[model samples]
Target: MREVRATDLPHIREIYNYYVANSTVTFDEDAMTLAEWRDKFYYLNKQGMPFIVAVSPAGQILGYALVSPWKQKKAFRFTVENSIYLGAASTGKGLGRELLGELIKRSKAAGLKEIIAVIADQGADASIKLHRDFGFDEIGRMGKVGFKFERWLGTILLQKSLK
Candidate 1:
């Protein structure tokens, strides 16, 4: 894994777009342009957030993990919301564990005291378990909070304290 570079956005976007188009991993119903995606990452990087990509030995991006503000208010400054995405072919390979672990390490280094993961109720059992294995506790489950694909999807909120 390594810090995300500007050149890495295309590959990263590709991985994300696959899920956006075909999976319930995210609630995003539409795909974003490369420029918009680049700007999004730029803002996070500018704010000193860590956006990392896991690359194969041949340098292909296999997955990515990032940390962003949990909330806009200053009182929430010491906590962050995390996101991790991998290529469809990359799941179940233990890459998610390594990627999340790295995000936690970087979050702690950034002086973050809390990490929040909001996982979808559908198709995220593995993710919830992954967070649990890494010491995050499920604080709550929001019932039918989001609608996608003609269905209501709930969210599980998990928290991990770096302190």
Candidate 2:
């Protein structure tokens, strides 16, 4: 695992778009464009946040993890929301655990005080368990807040304090 580079966005987009198209892991009903991913990369870079990627020996991006401002308000500067995505072939191989662990460590070093995870309630049991394993606690849940794939969905909010 290492810091993400601009050239990795395409692979990152592919991994993320797969989830957008095939699963409820993300509520995005449409695939994100490469330009959007670029914008996100720049935003994270400017904020001095961590955006990490796991690559294979051949230099193929297998997964990525990142933290962004939870809210734009000044008072929320120390808190950020985290996102992690692995390629279809990379799951269940302990990559998520390593990526998340690295993400938390980097986030803390970046001076972030809190990390929040807003996870989709459907088809995201693994994510919930992963966060719990890392000491993130369930803060709350919002039901029927999202409508996607012709169904109602909710979110589970988990939080961890770095201080």
Candidate 3:
């Protein structure tokens, strides 16, 4: 795993677009363009957030993890939100665990008070378990809070207190 760079946008976009188009991993139904992703990278950089990518020794981008502001309010500065996406082929390969672990560690090091994960209910069991394993407690669950693919989806808000 390494820090994601501007040149990594294509591979990152490809991995994310796969999730956006075919999976419920992200609520976004439309594929993101390179410009949009570049803007995201820029925003994260400006916010001093971490954008991490897992790549093979051969330079293949397999997955990415990011920690971004949970809310823009100054009062919420100590809290951050995290997301990790692994390519279909990278699943079950320990990539998600490593990536998320790094993300949490970096987040805490960056002086964030808490880390929040808003996970979709269906494909969330493993992710929730992962968070729990890392000491993130289940704070709340918002039932039917989102809709995608013509169906209602629930979101679980998990939290890890860094303080």
**Tens-digit per-residue lDDT, 1-163, candidate 3:** 7889999998889999998988786888889999999999999988889899999999999999998899999999889999998888999888889999899878877888889999998876888888889898888988887899999998898998888
lDDT of 1 by residue, 1-163 (tens): 8999989999988999888888777989888789987898889987788889999999999999999999999999888999999998899999999999999999888888999999999998899999999999989999998888899999999999998
Worst 10 residues of 3 by lDDT: 122-131
Residues 37-156 of candidate 2 have per-residue lDDT tens digits of: 999999999999999999999999999999999999999999999999999999999999999999999998999999999999989999999999999999999999999889999999
Every model's TM-score: 0.97, 0.99, 0.96
Model 1: how far residue 147 lies from native, Å: 1.0
Regions more than 4 Å wrong, model 3: none
TM-score, structure 2 vs. true: 0.99
Model 2 clashing residue pairs (backbone): none
**Best TM-score goes to which candidate?**
2
Clashing residue pair totals per candidate (backbone < 3 A): 0, 0, 0
Ordered from best to worst TM-score, the candidate numbers read 2, 1, 3
Clashing pairs in 3: none
